[model samples]
Target chain A: MAHIVFEQVTKQYDNGFVAVKDLNLEIGDDEFLVLVGPSGCGKTTSLRMLAGLESISRGSLYIDGQRVNEKSPRERDIAMVFQSYALYPHMSVFENMAFGLQLQGTAKPEIQQRVQAAAAQLGIEELLDRKPKQLSGGQRQRVAVGRAIVRDPSAFLMDEPLSNLDAKLRVQARAELTKLHKKLGTTFIYVTHDQVEAMTMGSRIAVMNQGILQQVDTPQNLYEHPNNMFVAGFMGSPAMNFFEATLTQTGEQMVIDAGALQLPVPEEVRSRYQSLLGTPLIFGIRPENIYNPEFAPPGINPVAIEATVSVVEMMGHEEIVYFALGDGHEFLARVDPRSRFTPGESVSVSFDMNRFHLFDKASEHVLVS
Target chain B: MQDASNIMRLLGAIAAIIVGSGGIIALFYVANLVVNRLPPRPRSQILPWVYMVPALVMLGAFLVLPTLRTILLSFMDRRSQGWVGLDNYIFAFTNADMLIAFRNNVLWLVLVTGVSVGLGLVIAVLVDRVKYEPLAKALIFLPMAISFVGASVIWRFMYAYQPPGTDQIGLLNAIAVALGYEPIGWLVNKSVNNFALIAIMIWLQTGFAMVLLSSAVKGIPKDVIEAARIDGASEFQIFWRITIPMISSTIVVVSTTIIVLVLKVFDIVFVMTGGNLDTDVIASRMIKEMFNFRNFGRGSAIAVVLLLAVIPVMVTNIRRFQQQEANR
Candidate 1:
């Protein structure tokens, strides 16, 4: 119901620690924008500032085009689910859900009806009279959510709401929250350190590091094209592998020379590297993009290289093979499980040249042609 | 012969010490042995009570027997030689001095309990947010370490009075003289004397209430308060709706404790004014009746009244504790 904007939002504590540095994010109405980062990355601080729980030190915040920097949380009409659930332990589940309505002076019957509706929506109708201490963790989590939804606020700000649940329940709750967001169609600004939750639930994930907003993009876009070394390494499991290499012109071809192995640039992209010849660069490739020569995918601009297998992890779907070059540069490859490979075996592997990435060695920014 | 008799006395004293302690152990050991030989079902049923025998016997002899004797003596004459029926009870309820004591006791109960707990809770909430919280709390709680008699003695000097023409030595009279007002006798003025005594008791009991209530307030989770704020509760609303209800159990505990203490308030009245000038309370009057007047039946009747007054408060406390246990 509200489109929240953070214009140069910065959170500087009294101890001189800047938690969030000039973060500017635009969350559209009904958008599920997740602020994701590692711990101490200021994601929760950002959400709290939006919820009016924390004061914005140096920025203007707007909800539906109206500046709300000075407004209290009640005036902002935002409901929040805390990481600890924060349900009133003394109140029964029904009373917990009815509290906000009662405070707003909503009629008693309407309060009861709305609470009942939210409880039914959460499939927690039987738990109305039970206190928070009497419920299981999952039930308490639902009650927290139900308490927020009963108020029907402009937006719902959840700070890692599912983190307390067990892994299986967390996954189930993740899907339920996504469905709830869609059903409610209210803007949700969720804060979590979990990459999987951000990738799965967020319409757009804003990745942050060291109080700086690194990138804000869709999950697929972030996976396919990260802006810098941190994003590239942080996005995928087992991470993308990097090699310190130099782009050298070997007559008609530009070959990346890393001393251990040399990879010839495919002719289609060779012209883009001609001007950068004799310059140092960092070459990167995803684990899934590397393959055993015998199981290499067709239509790839393949460049063959040789290495020794240092370790083999036999995952049922695929094997994660660790390879070491002659110069002792090691990298992981996700290859076909059926490929016969073992530790200490010399093998030929093919790199999908079309999928490789190059970055400036000094700046670490991805090179674009 | 004197040396020999001294050695014998020493030997007898050591033997008595050992025998007394050993006798208690042997009694419990023999009881456990006897219970063990019974059928398993009956043994299980009777084992706990067997262990409780010493305590129960002591309670019966010291508590139950005295209470029964007091009740019995209440219905007899001054010498406890003939039945007087309701004469002593009527005197307890209708006598002019006893009436003043009852009124004073009620005033103490309401004002002392109300002000101490209310002030304690308010101070607790305020200090919780201050930077020097521990220091402030320690200072506020220091008075609780003083016994009721000691606190009353301290306040006696505080409320000390002198004639207007004389140099004022008491803190209150000194302040009044500095302000150019005539020095007033705080404990002798019948209209305000009970209030003066009650203030001293409040000064002593407030600290006890504050310490307990402060801990209860600290036990409330921080995030819960934050959630309430986000749920549209103002600072005042949060205190009333969230804080008060959250620490209500502790409030009940502190209230009943202060109430019981107030009901048996004697030391302040006794030490400050000796129940003169309309400062008499139930406990102080009971003491005077039993020891000074030496009226056995009337004293017993007043003692029974004080016990009856305290029973309801104790019952409520027990019921609350039981409910808490059942919830757990």
Candidate 2:
């Protein structure tokens, strides 16, 4: 078990391109921390710095409180599973898993025992003698994981290990990896650009953009209380919708004036934005927060607005409806599938007043998170 | 009578043409018919050899027969009149000039193969990471395009000697004279002539070795090397454990090819020094014995020795290829 820390770590290439900047992250022992971002977002660079694969340009890294900035990867005592499942093509599966142990000069009997236990754990016992090319992609993925397991290192670093598998196999492998993490209770730091994988597997997800950390929080917390516009839009599928609007105080309540529609904020949450009463702000709402009036759940403080339904997607349990307002502002809502809303029909949708988010227009930071 | 004889010759020509082309077709047709009439088990057993007959016949006539004749002549007199029974072999092994040839062949085998492959592997690894890799590889591999005799001629000018004289024209002598040292005769000096000849062969072959080895080095995936580093392998360990084994097959191919080429080394020695001044090798000596001295028995004996030396290298290479195919 290991607690890994990146203290203001920065990576700058020789050509003056900064791949990662001022990354500060603390991963506790036995925690499955996922570094999630889009392509070229520096998540992989940060992970590589921690793995000692890439050099840390400006700041220090610590593993169990040891400064390992100058240490080589071999001295770091961490194992990584590459996205390609980089098994040695010339070696048998057994030898592939035993390679690290052999390098460390582990006893023959112990190496054999550890390798067998790992293979049995991964349910790949029958594939011990087969070469890497002889195995299917999913089997190779397991062998890559099994190779890391045999090392019994303090941490496991996985760089998009499931991205190469087919869709169905990726889902299956995702669950198996989570179960394995829980069984081993080792610190797992996984890097991927897939948000769904991040949400499903990470104990806590760290989101990054443009070489900077945007937010680090639990999956539920990140969805319910995102810190900025990027996080709110990035975390959920179909994304959160935003409207350019102004907030005004009316008597004792606050109202959002979004040009096309106006809705009063809930009395309980009104005081959170009273100081910015007449300032232009951005209003945000997730797809799930908007609902069809007929099937809107009770006690959500629903405020009704009229719009024309442009398209409807029936998803068995719910419908994803695209709505266009009178001012041409468009948004989507996940409503109850039983409500038969169709295209070209005027429908009244309810916005949960308590769940709406307000952000400062200039900074795009949450005004009332 | 003349017209009658001409008519008869034309008829005979027609008969010969018919027998030549039609005979082969008819023979194959009848053999196919006979094989089709047999049971399936015997038919399957006989079919492959039937298909192999033409190639096997050609090999037997061209290769097998000549080799047997050469062996037979090795035991006979110079004119192949009577059985001399190992006298030529005794002369080949015991002669003073033949001993020098044997020693020089061994030197070529060891030094030329080792230096060429070693230099090729080192250059391949270092050049792969550079930005101007293609240009650098092209420059290094350009020497392979030159034939051995052409390369020897180029080096001959480089090694030309000018007897401690005024304004030496040879490149080496000019450098020595410019440095205030006496001009040295490179080819005439027995000590340096063999080495000079070997250097020419190395120059021609290192490029061939480099092209093969560079591709082999590049064939290893980058991730495998990175994984080795993360698995706690030092750089040296990674090279030994991952890089070497990954390119072992290519290395074997390059080495055996160089060995075969080095064993039959004749062109450079013949072009540069004509095997004089203690620079004789097996192939050049065999040629001299056969053509210049008209000693067929001694030449055949030397040829048998060269064949014996090369057989194991070829056999090992074939086995390696078969193993790789089986794995695939």
How do the predictions measure up, each by TM-score?
Answer: 0.87, 0.81
Tell how far residue A181 is off in model 1, in angstroms: 2.9
Cα displacement (Å) at residue A10, model 2:
1.5
- Candidate whose TM-score is highest: 1
lDDT values for all models: 0.91, 0.92
Can you give the DockQ of every candidate in the order shown?
A: 0.68, 0.63
Clashing pairs in 2: none
DockQ of 2: 0.63
lDDT string for model 1 (A179-271, tens) is 999999999989998888999999998999888899899999987888887788877887899999899886787788878869888887787
Report lDDT (Cα) of residue A306, candidate 2: 96
Interface RMSD of every candidate?
0.7, 0.7
**Per model, how many backbone clashes are there?**
0, 0
Error of 1 at B10 (Å): 15
